[model samples]
Target chain A: MTTPLLEVTDLKIHFFTDEGVVKAVDGVDLTIERGKTLCLVGESGCGKSVTSRAFMQIIRKPGKLVDGSMLYRFKKDDGTDEIIDLAKLDPKGKPIRQIRGQEIAMIFQEPMTSLSLMHTVGQQITELIRLHTGATKHEARNRAIEMLQRVGIPKPDRLIDEYPFRLSGGMRQRAMIAMALSCNPTMLIADEPTTALDVTTQAQILDLMLELQNDYGMALLFITHDLGVVAEIADDVAVMYLGKIVERSDADTIFNNPKHPYTQALLRSIPKIAMQRDELEPIKGMVPSPFRRPVNICQFQPRCNQRFEACSRVEPVSTLINENHSVRCLLYEDVAAVHQADTEAVAHG
Target chain B: MWQYILRRFTYMIFTVWIISLITFAVIQLPPGDYVSTMVSQMINSGMDELPPDFEQEVRAQYGLDQPIYVQYYKWMRNIIRDGEFGYSWIYRRDAKDIMVERLPASFAISAFSVLFIWMIALPIGIYSAVKQYSLADYTFTLIGFIGLAVPNFLFALILLFISYKYMDQAMIGLYSQKYETAPWSLAKFWDLVKHLWIPVVIIGTSGTAGLIRTMRANLLDELNKPYVDTARSKGLSETTLLWRYPVRHALNPFISTIGWILPSLIAGELIVSIVLNLPTSGPVIFNSLMDQDMYVAAGFILILSTLTVLGTFISDLMLALLDPRIRLS
Candidate 1:
């Protein structure tokens, strides 16, 4: 098979605060292929946003990328494949900058604040286009206008001159998307881009993003806590809990046959139209504090109604039950032990 | 925009008129008028006694014998119709003349001090915020606190003593003894520039420190804004990202402060002016108010208030220009 567009291996980002270290993202593994969407599903403070930011190397101070390798595969001008380890490059250096907006662009959650109110929409979009493509003023302006039109902004000509505040919430987010896609990036990291919009606008934005994804054929890393959105758009779903992906597989398998207790609890908690308000089943407990994560045990054991004694005694490793389905739970420990033995035997041989 | 400006202008005129009324009333509020002070001075000068009607004649001559409202109406009429700010009792000249004589020097000194404050405060504030918690930031913070704590006049005296003792320079007044009464020439201007730094530094220190704190706080708040993150994600260099986005937003406070700066041009750093012995409106206003020189005191105050209103209008216009979120309407 051809190499994936981006491969993230054991990525760990820790924030060193005045209080002890916050393991915001610990040992996450993800892969995204060209023209596909990988939905990172997690609740607040579960490091989904942090993981996406690490892709652009825009993590703020006191947060350090402790360990990882992000191997990005792209085609050069000569049509030959080249690989670069993004984790090794300096965030402030020229090489990473060339890749940041041009190769892997990001759109943030708060569309209202993500675009500068002081600048016109055209200026912001043209600035990125010019920075990445070195296009002349006229070219950049035309490109920005085209981008705005592509994102379905009405009256792109007049809207280009307006500031972010002049636009509605949905339109502002559209502008942000236009700016991100202006450089024709190979990967797009969207961090809950529609969370701030109204329900109608959110649906429209999602459709727009899917249409754009199809047109651009870029690898889309869509981060959100909305399972409905995941069901609607995600081809591959990775359910994160307390900074760890407990279950990952194709969207159908994840929804139809969730293996991890956390994933099961999450799926069960979704309130259906037929259910009464009091009939909704929430997961048993709050996500454990990041500082005091459960050690030598399954991270979800405390909240798992089906948890067994072995869950508290041994940490569960990711075990492959079948092709395209992996879960981190002691319920699959028998399969994990066999897989571990097979890998060890091969290594020893 | 034109409509907005015109509206603000009208409001400014009304505000100035009200301020003038209050200033005139406050100047007259003290128990004695200028004539009483002059009479008291005459008695202290060893005049055994004056004619009983002498005081009345002097009072009538200056229109002080009239009722307060009548006097106010006359003062207002003179200002409106003839463009006169009444007469200065002590200076024995038009109140406008005294203001004109001292205003240029005052304006020059104040303008220089503001320039000094802005030029120094901006970069240091940016640096302190960008490199927050660095050694340089801490050092600047310490210096800024000291600057805020020390009174301007005391700092002025310290600078004066330092200049006199170590540099063998008197550093008092706006110009040297030779240029004390010298008319405006290139040489006089050059001499003024040479002596300008001492007063500029003295008057600017507290403001500079205050602005540094303001800028640092403002920039720190802006630095973490999501827009800044968006800018960084655009592959712009850190410096370019900072100056283009967050720094522009952080400058709102500085623009808003232009309102106070204009009035400060005439009346800022009053104690520092006295300590440094500069020829500025502060000391003139002080003396006039002390002796109840009604028109002189009232005139200076009225002009200062007008400037304040005009400055606020200008600042509002500038803020609208800078921030698109602020609609003039």
Candidate 2:
């Protein structure tokens, strides 16, 4: 009934290199409701990280958001809903800066390298707090200490003065989380934040993130290639291939009744308990290079086992199978056409 | 930290002692002493060969008749006890006085050249790295290569020619003719400043070019690091992000280079000083070595070695201060 926290429509990000333009993120659409998790699952170079970076307007040079509008909804001081198109704002201008860490914050993959070794963890945390909140030095310090404690770090007082290199990988990730959550942002974008951690530490970090998300009631955009993590944390799932999303649905539907062949292939690839190690089946073929994207056809057709004749000639648009599920595949075109006709007939009647 | 510094200082003293010993020995390695050179000069001028007693008397007067170790011990003891640097045979004065007189000018030129190098190289290097592969970056790379390829003395000559031909100004010495022998005064200082730029530019060229390449490469590497992106994601301004993160890391290498600057104060730009006719330590040392002026040459070199040790110690301390990882280790 209420508007989603953020709605991204037709997002396209291109990287212009000397060789050619790399359509790194082409036509990605996503929605994140308040207090829910959206896991973007994809293989490497599939543009999941790039899409999340676009939300923060932190895309590095050579890669640019060439099209799309990100409609972000937030409450003003007067308790009224206000909408802004994030894509239209100048990335380097003051408006985006004010909204960046305050409204939407991000955590990265490499905790060891994400925090600057030159500054104390306390200094890094307080810098963000003061930048957005305009808090006094003493206030920022106290807030940073409190945040460090909240992130489950022991002896926050002592660790505050320690440099990032002095902390373990999990502790560094925790510090990063504390810094991201310090501003009480409405949305958090985490790009494979646990990829570098061991299994135990990864699980701890995931639990901490879930607890924090529940407490803050913030929308989470979790990007990862790990299906196990997605199953554990994601309420909604979107499968990405190359630069396009192939399937999106509620987590249960995606796990139980995956519509797109790419999603099925990805599910089959995950190693299961009680199964032999050699029994795992990986998706066939390398992801086609971004420079040579398939023309006028489904991006996943080459990798799909059940691909039909129409898949090679027609690019599949997102087709709704039900109220809560959508897939981009030529197999579902007839269902989408029937649904469209029904909607049109009802509107006329 | 204090203990570390004290240990380093101790090592520095030992290093300086070894350097002094080596310098004294190397200076004495030539075939003859200053007295023999003087006798040869006198004989070449058509005088009859000096009597055997005359050469022995001259050698005894200069302490040259003593064993090499005894000569070294006496020189070192005199320097440690009374700050004396023995006697200059060529200038007929104390070596200390000659060094004190010429060293300030050399120090000024070297200090200003280092300042010039840092000031120009830092901003341009940061710019070149941030705008890598841009037209400006390419232009600076070209200029840096040219600076590094051309020798300092040759560059000095070219600058002198340019200034003479185009500006009609003979940019040759540290001061105009009037201020050459003038005592220390505001006017003499200003005249020195007016002529200081040429040598500063010449000496600083290669160092500046080298530092620019270093800084650009260092900063370019730092710029891609994940910490930079993390800082940017915090909504810091681009300039703030750049200066606070990558530039801070890039500056570590430059801090370590401060060690070499002290020795370069006396030894750098030797030919440039000779070509420009400046009254600096480089030419004085050169002439002293050529004439077998043992005390003056040894004293200058000893001071240069001591400075090098002190500079390295200072740079180590500065590096530890800048990087916490180094500090803890």
Candidate 3:
């Protein structure tokens, strides 16, 4: 099988601040195959957004990617295998510039601010196209309008010249998406794209993104805290708690059989619209402060019900419970022995 | 917008008129009238001791023999109706001409100082903000305090010493020679600038310190704003992020204050020019006040007032440009 489009292995982002060193993203590993969607779910301050920003190499001052190897394996123009290590790419070098926007585009939260207030929405999109593709102004203009229309913007010809402030929140988001997608990038990193929109608009944007992903055959890295959103768009899910990935697996396995107590608590906390109010159970206790993180198997030990004494003594490694699913949890350590014991007992009974 | 301008202009006129009236009154109330002073000085110097009729002639010449209210009424009428600034007793020329000649010099010095101040402050301030608490920031802060603490006269003395000791030349104080040396030629103007630069810088150094501190504080605030982070997430270059968003936003307060900055600097230039003996408004007004040349003093005041008004207007326009939310309306 060919390598995935993007693979982030052992990613760690730390911040050196006046207070102390903060491990913002500790040992986060994620993969997105071609045309697949990987949703990162966590509460506020969980470092989900930091991990996504790390992918784009846009982490701000005082925050830095201390260690990480992000490998992008894609087919070059000559159909030759090309694998570039993102960690090795110089931030100012042409390779990173070539990948940013041309290969991977990002959709930011707060569309109004993300879109340049000074430029017309169309101009912003057209400029990006011209910058990456070297298209003539006229060609880029047409492409921009087409992208806007494809994104379901009304009267793309007229709307293109309007500023972001002139457009509604939903329309601005669509304009942002159009701008990001105008370059025809291979991967889309949507960083809470729908967090600021109204619920109805959120659904529309999510659907539009999914539709575009399908049409363009692009991989997606969706960074959000809303599990409801995850349930809808993600094929794979990663749960982060205090800068570390607490649990990660196929979406089905993660939703059905969450082994890590934090994952289970997160799953339980998501209020179900289909179920009664009383049936809903939210996660107990707040996420621990990153500054006060303990050296142990689980960062969730304080809130986790299944946490044992041993969990505080040593960190747990990821254990593969199935061919496609894996989780970092002490509870999953005896799964194979338990399965064998259950088989013998059932036969005797 | 037009209404706003009209209202501001009206208020400016009212303020100038009130200040001028108070100045006129105070100058008149002083002991030893201008006519008596002239006559006494003539007699004391034994300059043929003006004829016995000279006392009446001097009083009549100045219209000082008229009632105070009447003199004030005529003065107001001449200013309002004839648009005439009366002659100066000391200069023996129209007060308006003296003011016109001297106002530009003061303004030039002020303008040059302001330009230097902003040019130096902005970059240093921005770098200090970006480097925050680094050695550069601490060093600049220390330098700013020094600039603040040193008085203009002392600064002028220091500059003179530096020029004499290092450059092996005597420092220019104000003019090349005196006001009678030459008319305002380009060479003379440049010479005047060279002479005045030390004083101008001395006066402006404090202002530069203030501006640098303000810019640093503002830039820090802008850097911490969420929109700056949003800009970063858009894959914008660091230069663009710093200059386009943070710098522009940070400059709004400084830009808006330029109107006040220019006039206030001009006011400050007055004192510095006097100390440095520059042929500028400070000494001109100071001489007129001592000689009871009310017209020249009032005229100088009026010119400075006008500059302040115009400065504020320019600042308003700049604020609108710098701050997007300040719409044209």
Best by lDDT: 2
Superposed on all Cα atoms, the candidates' RMSDs to the truth, in angstroms, are 3.4, 4.4, 5.7
The CAPRI class of candidate 2 is medium
**Best candidate according to DockQ:** 1
lDDT of 3 at B77: 90
lDDT of 3 by residue, B119-204 (tens): 88899999999999999999998998899888777787778889779987666555655544687788887776667668767877
- In model 3, what is the error at residue A345, expressed in angstroms? 33
Q: Mind giving the per-residue lDDT tens digits that candidate 2 earns over B278-313?
A: 988999999999999999999999987787788888
As a TM-score, model 2 comes out at 0.93
Q: Arrange candidates by lDDT, highest first: which order?
A: 2, 1, 3
How many residue pairs clash in each candidate at the backbone level? 0, 0, 0
Where in model 2 is the C-alpha error above 4 Å?
A: A335-349, B52-67, B158-171, B177-183, B264-267
lDDT tens digits, residues A114-181, model 1? 99998999999999999988899999999999999999999998999999988899999999999999
Worst 10 residues of 3 chain B by lDDT: B320-329
Give the candidates in order of TM-score, highest first.
1, 2, 3
lDDT of 3 at B138: 96
List the pairs of residues colliding in candidate 1. none
